[model samples]
Target: MANRIHPTAVIGDGVELGDNNDIGPYAVIVGPTVIGSDNWIGPHCVIGTPASDRGAPHPAAWHDAPVGDPEQDGFGVRIGDGNRIREFFSVHQGTKRPTTIGSNGYFLRSAHVAHDCRIGDGVTLGSNVVVGGHSEVWSLANLGLGVVVHQHSRIGPGAMVGMGAAVTREVPPFTISRGVPARVTGMNVVGLSRRGVSPEAIAELEPYVIQGAGELPELPAELAKLLTEWAREGHRGEH
Candidate 1:
């Protein structure tokens, strides 16, 4: 099927769009961007703009960034298939690399994805959710309405942040967090169950969530691996 792009929509030069996309009226997609199939880009959405790095000494400083194009430097957004980007959503490009959104994302109205973010598959960013620069949201994570994530933090796979939470640190996989500073409240048992994770596996991982736990209990192989990786990444201060 052919792509349905509205005449009022502005698709810039060098933009690559795959089949069956529906670009809404007045949606502005700028160049060096690649969008995959079956995306619903809603009205007034702006994509592939330059990163908002105003702290750089000079305007031309972004030109010399390590990654991205020298000529069209800082102007690239890569979006995968089957995304529903609602009205007024905006996504900026990277300073060094492309800001990437994985497949099957549901970005609600006025959701903002800032520069260099790596959003994984099946992610849901609720209305007015704002993700700061360079943050990584893992697969199947859900950010509730008006949630704000700080720069360089990681939201783990299957994690859920409650409404209006201010996330300042890394959220562990399959955890539920809420509050101004976003403290880990409990395991994401419901989320894991919905994903078909066994009850035993959930039980095994529960001990890890206890505060001040110096040692991890013996867990399933997959859970153990995930915990190890999470610890390593947390140690690197990626939050």
Candidate 2:
């Protein structure tokens, strides 16, 4: 049940890592960070660093330990279990609250998750994807390579963003959004199919996202729960 931390990896104070974590060489993990089990943290990943927010303190830049004070660590970062964070990935600490990452995420090389973001489970952030502060990428979303999500935006569940797009607006669930300022080109039928959503359900759900209005179809329980919350918040016509 012991963690496999490389000799060169710097595990600073206040870090709480769970069992069976494979932390690669030169990966610096500072705390207040609570990383769950079965994570493969690749080399040179800098996690739990102070926020780049102009207002947050910058003690981590010069201090031997990134999070010099446990309380002044620019807020906390909590990453869930079964994640594969590739080399050169950086997740900054939150400016107001904890930057939370749910279980089973795959962050590719050089992806940057900025402060106060909430990344849901089964999300795939492709290489060099930059998610701005306070953003929420809902479960099962796929952000392609070099996609830049605007600050405070939300990428809804099962959405697919094309490579190298600048996402300035919200992306609705199960849609294929592309282009600068990203618009919904079509439904993500492929992704929906992969998720085992039936043709009947996909048909029923199409109007909800397309028109960006109305009640949700009787989707699968998991889909229903997530989208219902999204709908209840009146996220219509903002996509």
Candidate 3:
């Protein structure tokens, strides 16, 4: 199949696009950008472009840093296959490194992934969600609308960040976090089950649900026994 770029779109020099990508009307894509196959870029979305550096010399601002020389090198955006970036969603290329979006991820309308953010596969960011620069969202994690993830924090695999939550610390795997400071409500049982987690693993994980600790304490004795049994029984690959 041939590449189809809308006549109103502005595709910059050195940009690389794979087959069957639909570039929306008036959307701008600047290079050093590489977009993979079957991705949908919605109308008026600006990609692979640096945010305008408008702040004064704060000594810590990206525009004032010493690494600013060779400006565009090592800085741009790379998106994998089958991702959908919706209308008006602004995804900026990195200032110091590449902004990487994994395959099968969905960015809803008005969602913003700031520079240098790493989003893993099958993740979904709801409308108006913001991911700070340098933050890592692991595979299959879902962030509800208006969630704010601080830079440098890690959101673990299969985690769910509730709407309006502010995450400052690491969100553990298979859990749901909500509220202002983001407390864990419970295990992400539905998410785990949908991914085919074994009944034994769920049973194994059930007894150690201690509060204040987001996940099970590092393989406690009872949980470990079940895990060992599950592994020995050849059912360790579901989740």
Candidate 4:
């Protein structure tokens, strides 16, 4: 299972490619980078560029780390197995630390994963999505096309961010977001069903809850407590 690097690709020193990877034409991979098995890096994608050189750091840049690392090469990107990174997507290596993407994530065309981000498994980033640095997108989260995640916010496991949404704060698990500022519309009903979440559980959660972001404060303490319990359970249940 050797890697397939396109003739036009520029693979720099310290770059490690795993088995069966496809490096598309004109893709640039600056090193100290480690890409896992079955990765599809599409055409014109830039991987592991030195910091400072990437130009003015975005405001969400600190979301990756505290910043101010003397050497840009000190930052690196670590991608797990089975990821499909589409054309024109850019995944920046970490600054002061390593940016990590878990297994089974899909990045559609033009999606951006900034420095120091920690993405969990089974995540899907739609076209033109932008994930700010140092952000944490938990497992099973689906970000819609053109969604913009602010720096340092945590996307809870199983969250669904709708297209064109601007997410400034954390999105709790099993919630669906859509709006200018991205309000939670409801639970991810379809997602839950697909995953085989029992109907009784969904029914119980739907009633004791307020559906939107603003209403989180209004949810009953008992429900809030239960949410915490459920999250703990999920953590323990992960494979």
Candidate lDDT scores, in order, read: 0.82, 0.87, 0.73, 0.75
**Clash number for each model:** 0, 0, 0, 3
Question: Which pairs in model 2 have colliding backbones?
Answer: none
TM-score of each: 0.83, 0.92, 0.77, 0.78
Q: Write the per-residue lDDT of candidate 3 for residues 1-239, one digit (tens) a residue.
A: 77777898888764789999998998878766788999989998878666434552213222232234324555777889999889988877676678889999999998988888888888999999888888888777899999999887777667798999989877766578998888777778887677666666655554433222233334435334433543354433312
Candidate 2 per-residue lDDT, tens place, 84-143, comes to 999999998887778999999999999999999999999999999999999999999999
Global Cα lDDT for candidate 3? 0.73
Compute the lDDT of residue 165 as modeled in candidate 1.
100
Better of 2 and 4 by TM-score: 2
Q: Evaluated with lDDT, which candidate comes out highest? A: 2
- State in Å the error of residue 109, model 3: 0.1
Error of 2 at 148 (Å): 0.4
Model 3 root mean square deviation, Cα atoms: 7.8
lDDT of 1 by residue, 57-165 (tens): 2232222323346346644689999999999999987776789999999999999999889998899999999999999998789999999999998898778999999
Judging by lDDT, tell me the better candidate of 1 and 3: 1
Name the better of 1 and 2 by lDDT. Answer: 2
In model 1, what lDDT does residue 218 have?
Answer: 59
Say which prediction, candidate 3 or candidate 4, comes out ahead on TM-score: 4
Candidate 3: lDDT of 80?
94
Better of 3 and 4 by lDDT: 4
Best-fitting candidate, measured by TM-score?
2
- Rank candidates by TM-score, best first: 2, 1, 4, 3
